[model samples]
Target: MKVLVTGGAGYIGSHAVQRLLRDGHDVAVLDNLGRGHREAVEALRASSGKEIPLLEADLQDRAVIAARLRELGTEAIMNFAALAYVGESVTDPLRYYENNTAGVVSLLQAMQDAGVKRFVHSSTCATYGEPEVMPIREDTPQSPINPYGWSKLFVERVLADHAAAEPGFAYAALRYFNVAGSDPDAVIGEDHHPETHLIPVLLNTALGKRESATIFGLDYPTPDGTCIRDYIHVSDLIDAHVAVMNELDPDREDRRQMIFNLGTGKGLSVKQIIDAVKEVTGVDFPVEHGDRRPGDPPSLYADPRKIREQLGWSASITDATTMVRDAWKWFQENPSGYASQA
Candidate 1:
């Protein structure tokens, strides 16, 4: 399979590109370098020793994308492009909608034009905002409280609509929870500007990037009085994407739109994650308690049974200790992320 991976220069996208290549598929990366670093993609190409062509173009240009898809003979598109910050979405709803939602529209149009029907979308568990039940399922109510979630939900809705109308169109929306850790080999890792993720933040604190890690809302109803989230390893998340591509048979008569939640089916609280980080790095970094941010649920994890039963996919490296240790290895290798090399 020849696939084009949007946002392939970003953390997760870069990892997915490596996974796809390892699965014996050709991949081309398309990224605008707005929120992604080109160095990650270059590092991947260097590490893998493969000529992964990268198209530095924005998704908004439908005509160019359509032409490029045709030129590259792309059989599928794996979209990981979008503004993903929840708090930033709350502050700038239009930006989220335009980039996350509207960007999908542009990509879908290009796919339709190029006769590329197979798509693997990067959705999020945030779409199931404030769920009443634990271990969220595929049928869980999607009531996003933030624009980031809404943006991804809108893309999912549009993909469903397209699939229903066009029999040739088939898509898999992988709704993922908190993705942590890095490539086990430390080839590529998470590096977001003004990073908001908990694991990386704690690791950075251990590296003395900041004075200490801030514990947000230490009064939640969880066991540790903090929010609990399912942290999926980056490697496992990429494996799920590969599983989706392998399972998607557009030629099948009973082909249907696919939706699955990707996670470890285990929730880890903020305090527990901090403890894991301390254990992995052997450092007790300073911590400061702060009020909880708005729209944050007390706990969020996934059932993950559907994907396991259907695709034979499950988190193989998502344990808390392994996640922290792998992430620590990446941080040690690239203390300042790709910027140090730049």
Candidate 2:
């Protein structure tokens, strides 16, 4: 299968590309280098022994995207492009709407024009928005509290509508939780500017990149009085994506649209994650308690039974210890992340 992976130079996208290549699929990366690193793609190409074609362009460039879709003869598109920071999205809603929502509209138009029907969308659990229920399911009502969540939900609606209108279109929206860990080989891993993820932030603090890791809200009603979240390994998350790609039927007259929640069906608190990092790296790091960020849910995890029974996909890397261990290995190898390669 020849696939075009948008934002393939980013952390999760690059890991997805690596999985695609390893599965014997031809992959091309389309990234604007806005939040993506070019070195990640190069490292993937080197590690996979494949010349991964890279089209440096934005998703909103309809003409360029359409041309690239036709030029590459892409059979499928795995879209990972978006502005994901919840705080940033709150500060600038227009940017989030334009890039995350409108950008998908442009990509959909390009796909429609080029007759590329299969799309694997990288959705998020943020769409669930402070659910009162535990272990969120696919049927959970999408009442997103933040602009970032709304942006993703908007695109998801677009995909659903497109699939309904076009009989040939097929799509899979994988709503993910906190995706952590790196490739076991330590070749590629999480790298973000002013990283916001809990595990990586704690690991960075462990590495002495920062003074201390802040624990937000120890007053939440949980096992440890802190908010808990589901953390999935990057490799396992990509595996589910590829599984959906292979399962998609672009020629189906019914126009199949699949939505799945990808997670380990477990939640770990912030303190637990910090403790795991300390255990993994054997580093006692300073910690500071802080107020809860507004709109933060007490607990967010996935049921995952739907995807497990339907797609026969389940997360294999379930332990927080393993996640922290793999991430710590990568951090030790590339203390400056992709910058070390540059």
Candidate 3:
């Protein structure tokens, strides 16, 4: 299958592209390079030894997307193009809506015109803001407290609307849980300008990128009075994408809009993660407790039974200690994210 991966130059997007190619599908990457790095794309080509065509373009512009889709003869689109900063989303809601929500609108139109049959949308668990249930399921109602979460929820609804109006179009919205860790080979890993992911932040502190780690709000109603979250490896998350495409093809009659939550059913608390990092890195660093960041929940995890029963897939993630070690390997190898980008 020939597919176009929007935002394919970013961390998770690049990982997804690598997996798609490894699974025997042809992929073309389209990214604007706003938040992504170019070295990641070049590195992917060099490491894989395959010529993965890349276009530096944004989906917000219709002409560029349509031209590229038609030129590439893209059969499917896996969209990962969005500005994902929860705190910033709270302060500047328009940016989040424009990048995440509005960007999808133009991209959807381009796909509709291009006759693209499948779209695997990169959504978030943020859609289930302050989850009322222990293990969040697909049917959970979306009530996002912040604009970022609301923007993701809005795109999910937009995809559902598109599926309803156009039977020719089909999609799978994978609501990703706490995605962490890097590829075991360390060719590509998670990197951001101002990193916020818990694993990376902890590792950065180990590397002295920051003074020390801040455990946000230690008064939560959890085991250690800290927040707990489910962390899924990057490789495990995108594997489910391939399964979704395989399960739902053009001829299938179950044209119903399908939603899948990706994560391990188990979880790790903030304090537990810190301990794991210390154990793996062999470093005893000072831990600081700060005021609770607004728009944060006490505890959140996953119930991946739906994806497991339906897609026959479950997370094969390394232990938190092992995950921390693997991440330490990457950061130690290249303290700065990518060689060229640095």
Q: Which candidate do you rate higher for TM-score, 2 or 3? A: 2
Q: Top lDDT: which candidate number? A: 2
- The residue ranges of model 2 lying beyond 4 angstroms of the native Cα positions read 253-255
Candidate structures ordered by TM-score, highest first: 2, 1, 3
Model 1: per-residue Cα lDDT over 1-342, one tens digit each: 999999999989999998998888999999999989999988888898999998988888899999999999999999999889888898889988998999899999999999998999999998988999998999999999888989999999899888888889889999999898888898888899989889999999999998998888988888889999999999999889988887787777454578999999989999899999999999988999999987788999999999999878899875689999988998998898889768
Writing each residue's lDDT as its tens digit, candidate 3 over 95-116 gives 8899899999989998877777
What would the TM-score be for candidate 1 when compared with the true structure?
0.98
Candidate 2 C-alpha lDDT tens digits along 119-164: 9999999999988888899999999988999999999999888888
lDDT for position 306 in model 2: 89
**Deviation from native of the Cα of residue 166 in model 1, angstroms:** 0.9
The true-versus-predicted C-alpha distance at residue 279 of model 2, in Å, is 0.8
**Each candidate's lDDT (Cα)?**
0.90, 0.91, 0.85
Which runs in model 1 stand beyond 4 Å of their true positions?
A: none
* Global Cα RMSD, each model: 1.1, 1.1, 1.4
lDDT, residue 282, model 2: 91
Q: Give the C-alpha lDDT of model 2.
A: 0.91
**Backbone clashes in model 1:** 0
TM-score of each: 0.98, 0.98, 0.96
